[model samples]
Target: MNSEARNQHVGKVTHHELKQTLGTWQLWGIAVGLVISGEYFGWSYGWASAGTLGFVITAVFIAAMYTTFIFSFTELTTSIPHAGGPFAYARHAFGPTGGYLAGAATLVEFVFAPPAIALAIGAYLHVQFPGLEPKHAAMGAYLVFMALNIVGVQIAAAFELCVTLLAIFELLVFMGVVSPGFQWTNFTKGGWSGADTFSMGSFHGMFAAIPFAIWFFLAIEGVAMAAEEAKNPKRSIPIAYVTGILTLVVLAIGVMVFAGAAGDWTKLSNINDPLPQAMKFIVGEHSGWMHMLVWLGLFGLVASFHGIILGYSRQIFALARAGFLPEWLAKVHPRFKTPHRAILAGGVVGIAAIYSDELIQFGGQTLTANIVTMSVFGAIVMYIISMLALFKLRRSDPNMERPFRAPLFPFFPAFALVAAVICLATMAYFNFLVAIVFAIFLALGYVYFLLTRHQRETAPTDALLEE
Candidate 1:
């Protein structure tokens, strides 16, 4: 065949072919499911830096940013509706360089998030079976979830919906069970971490707490990444984005307030199992509430663990299909119609991250903290680029079909952008080592993309535009 003919054929072969099986509710499930674990643990870490009040202030600010961001971001998802999510929007808005950075940041965000969650899952399991090793359980969780994802998208979405509902119900039950133990003094004790109200130390602590505050809504954007798999991208994507964020906002505040009020907030601030630990005050250590939390709580972590693995695999598949990563990673399973290779590749990365602390210590940071910081770094980068893309597309593609427009226009998106930049700066200042490592990774990936630019540039045009 001639070069043109060969290119045309390859275009057809390489185009993204993800199955569309997700309905509006399923899309909501994936969005909520991907971040439900945040309700279980990570947010408490904010208290370690800012105490209860300071962290609440930080969480409120972060919540505003997320609300604005989701509003602005849904416009892009509805209009573009590609598997690449931010990568697709960036590509359309700013071309190849922007796309690469966005995709790299997304890869970092989605890929690293799972390891942190896997560790949390391990902690939950270890709470139940005292003899079980956390790391072993983490590896087992990865293997099991990755396999479920490879089976089929429909099946995976169904499981996600089920587990997410159970997780939501569990949180409500927790709030009821702990409400009787609520004590204002307990919540406010050490609430400022010894910094006088509005002092510089308190300000710095609040800044340092941004990442943990972000934990409440982190990866909620993964809903956009599932656009290509949605049965009705335009309608369902918008519904999912709005409903998912609202559900998360309610849950985040409810859990944070009740958990803090139930006992000394400081005690649960930096632990892997905050809810159960807090419950120890109301119900004894061996109480039924604790037992239920230890067992049923696993569903919350598993929901996110399973959901994020789905997200990261699609991200990997999108990048690989775009020639940003190895092409084989883009292949869909013949029967399952899933990106099995990409799923397994992400599982490998998550497993490796889980063991990185023991395998190779870096700056003496624990594996969980390092991975969480790394994931936050990636998320902030994506947030900045995605917000910027919304502005750019407005200017560059003014006539593009938008099923949902952000309410406040420039102001809302601009707020989200500025907030994201601030959060990024704060994380870099507070967690310089993890920020440095993430920067190096992004730099290396960009350099590799530059070296391979010619290959991508010469690839079939249809495949490049298919996204």
Candidate 2:
């Protein structure tokens, strides 16, 4: 065979397939776990930007976008059912360049998100144990979760379900505990997005609050990453995505609203531990309920952190398999049948990100907030590309067997696309520095992608046949 033909063939690669151990419920666990952290924190930052009433409007709009996006995105997930998620969808709909863009964006969203969650995990731990260092705790979390993921998908999903359930229960408990203190007036205090009324300032705060509202549902699409390992993805993915989005919408609104009502919402608006802080206002800082929230709340953060590890690993494996990344990173564990190297690779990056607080600075924002915005930037980009792929595929591959067609057809996807564009523009406008850094990150990856094309093109199709 010619060198070009040789590069396109594969013969020695072991089957890179993951075991089909995920069911509808496990998929739901993953779907919920991937975003439950948003309920615990992050969204409150919107309040700081827009005020309680302003963030309220922003959250409702964001929730609508996510609702529409998930309904449409399910079509891609079930139709393609690939580990690469958006990358695979874009590749099938467009081509290699599209695949490269989606894959690179997925890496940014999945990889960067975990570090922010990890730091939150560390800070949560610090509240209970003043002796433990937050950074060390963050690094330790990466080690533990990465090991769990590398061991097996079933093990990882099960843990995700348990933590996710606990996390959900804790949110419910929080709303209930603080219910008596909830005053409608408190929610509207200094209302209109941060000002007393809707003004130029409110408009600015409203747009600036977009990313924080997005944080509420940011990584939920990551469920698409685990689609391949799902049992009967057509059926399970539909159930998981639909139910999961609804579950999250309720929790996000409830948590945000109740947290606002229980105390001075402004106090919770800018902090990482908003729930705990809000609870303390009602139950007293030294109260047992406040203490429980601080501890059990860790489950919410853990769920997202752990779930994203699973997500980023799968994206790495998929990109590697398609020769977008180093092919060796595609290997499935011989015994565990998991993407071991991919998991570890993402872990190292996340750990480094967790420690880069002093080494890197951007736009005078806290490292965690900046990281959250960075993750949101990647997610919105991926969302726009995924929706474009949906539109293109409907025309290009009309006969493709779609198990779950997006309801409302063009309308749903169109709404998602518009919302995503608004989000990306607003985020970049407000966070010019972080946006530049994010663009630089993607550009560097694209350069490496271009330089490595020859080797990747030459990779053997050895693993494809096994699959």
Candidate 3:
């Protein structure tokens, strides 16, 4: 094969054969794995138990925003199917400056999200074992999944497929067990809170809970970054996209509505990991099934971490190829055909995050949750940029062919942008310091960009540039 043709291939996927590699089921697995991993299960239950209606309202709002955002991206990806994701799309629409910011923000999102998932997995494992230190457990989880990703795409895909199937079964079973315990009164009585006398305070508190609810929907778009790796990306992508989203929508609504009816809000509210809480309530004791469900939930989190790393590394590779990062990050291993440097970089970031949390624990603040919360703030910023990119691209490239044009054109983008702004507004209101710290990181990225510009323009950046 010529260099150009070879460059377009992934594993056995030749330029012409890329479309044949993915059947509908495999693509659906990828998308569902990306969006509705193990973590989604517990969190959905927890948020539902907190303020079921309030949380559900926020969930729907975020889903609408993300649907708009993903549809816009689908249009962009179909026209210019690059692995860098929003950064590549932004670069095409708004040039290098916009691309650089989007890439930098995404790097923060990708780097922090994996560790956060690891930390969650570690916490759940600690709950199960009570012997493991959080950092050590997190490291083990990170190492295991990082190895899976670095081995090659097929291994990663297989792991994701297994985890996705297991997670779905786990959710269905939890729903079935908990169905008998749901309480109708839980959904009706003072369903709203933090407001007195039916005042605006109640309205504000309802909106304030957007982040906790929105977290469930945020993983959906992650599938887009895997476009280049998928066989038949153009067709497989939309199929997975629609199906994965519909699945989550149904699951979220069903879990929230039924769980709200089945269990008391206060019963599930105090728990961070709600799936186990629901199982414990439903089972009434620690049975083998309960243990199995808990472990499966933890597995789901690990699988999610795996999916995030796989997709994010591709973003790193694509950005590296486009000159936004060091070219080594773009290198695909000769045998593995994977971005080894990017994977290592992702590993380093995850370790740094865990280490910093350990230091805070040593300081007696136990600030790991706070640190992860900052990452949520950073993710919100990325969401804002993505929404803005949609609007900007619509005006800049109206003529570009889009296999899936975002419904209602500019209006959808505008609505999503508004919702993103609302989420940011709430983030600032509730956690202004976290928002400030997150912004400082963005500023740091900008400084890094300035310092590296000269090198990116002149340096060859990789010794193994050819392969």
Candidate 4:
């Protein structure tokens, strides 16, 4: 081989490969950790839009969409097994532009969700120490979790598993503590967005609640990003995705229903501390159980905040490695075999977002509400692209090896695709201002992609970087 070709081969094949040290259960940890926090908060906001009963209807529909999406999305993850997740599948299906869009949307989802969760962590801490500012607590969370992620994926996943289990246990404790106070009247009062029946008013509220309903399963799909690190992607991916969705569905419904029943659901409708506050209705504000919920509740937020940091880092690394992003972000730590630079890059965005929550306001939405909607918008867009990729790959590469075919094939993917489109439309309509902000982000990112395209095409350092 010529010197140039040999150099290209070595650079592509030998340098900066991510360590594949994750197992099926560890993958499960990361999957559940990514979405468990949704049950603790966010979903309650749907109650404001749709009330308890109406939000439950919205939640059920969102749950169905997620169920089908996870089942179908697994096919792509098992087959492609790239750290870029949906970006890899879309690129293989369409091309560079498809890849850039998917990567950017996933970037928006993972990058924005953490800052929202981090601020919640800070807010939770602020209640305990009146002197501490929530943003300070939030910025501290970013520093700690980003360091954990940069250290190593295996260690990060291990910590994720421990915290995830603890979070689940604490949520269960919350439900049990509040069960006695749960009454039918309390939950049903002011339900259906205060409508006597399912009217046009109720429809408006249900559609408005789409983003918050989505919160219950928002980042569950992030498991796809971890496929490259899984000890057995083909075997572990399906197990983690399927079981993770099921776990989250049961928990999401249980937590929301129980909390609503515990008191006047209206009071819980628009707050980040619904679960804790619901427990307070039962045990009193200063009860020991309330204190436990305040302190232990943080694990739910941390699991997601930490796990998403791991996710966005891998995505940035994958996109950069493929030359869609600056190649420096692709470099893995030589000793740790983790994408350290990618982790820090994502951290910078998240911390900036954490600080900007108070500074940036739109349509009367707070940082948590606005960013939650923004992340949901990114997620639904990515979901639609991913499902399209599944259909495209099936026809384009009929000879590809099949480990886990999406069950029911066309029907499952088609259902997921349609639901995602509807959700995206309704969310955009209801959150027009945030939608505009999201679009501007994509426009600028695309401009950056166009500028970088030529350099990567002519550069042969990665002769077949990802043809």
The most accurate candidate by lDDT is 2
TM-score: model 2 vs. ground truth: 0.96
Please write out the lDDT profile of model 4 over residues 136-165, one tens digit for every residue.
Answer: 999999999888887888899999999999
lDDT of 3 by residue, 416-466 (tens): 778878888887876666666678877887787777776454433222122
Ranking according to lDDT, highest score first: 2, 1, 4, 3
Clashes of each: 0, 10, 7, 0
RMSD of each: 1.9, 2.2, 5.0, 2.0
On a 0 to 100 scale, what is the lDDT of residue 424 in model 4? 91
Name the TM-score of candidate 3.
0.87
lDDT of 1 by residue, 1-467 (tens): 47886677577554458899999999999999999999998889889989898998999999999999999999989988888899988988898899999999999999999988888888777867889999999999999999999999999999999999999999998999999999988888778854435567888788888988898889999987788889999999888889999999999999999999998777897787889888898988999888888789989888998999998999998888777888788889988989999999999988998887864346677778788888888999999999999999899789888889988899999999999999998888888877888888999998899888756654444332454
| Clashing residue pairs for model 2 | 7-458, 9-460, 9-461, 10-460, 10-461, 10-462, 11-462, 50-193, 50-194, 54-193
**Model 1 accuracy (lDDT, Cα):** 0.88
In model 2, what lDDT does residue 79 have?
87
Which residue window of length 10 is worst by lDDT in model 4? 458-467
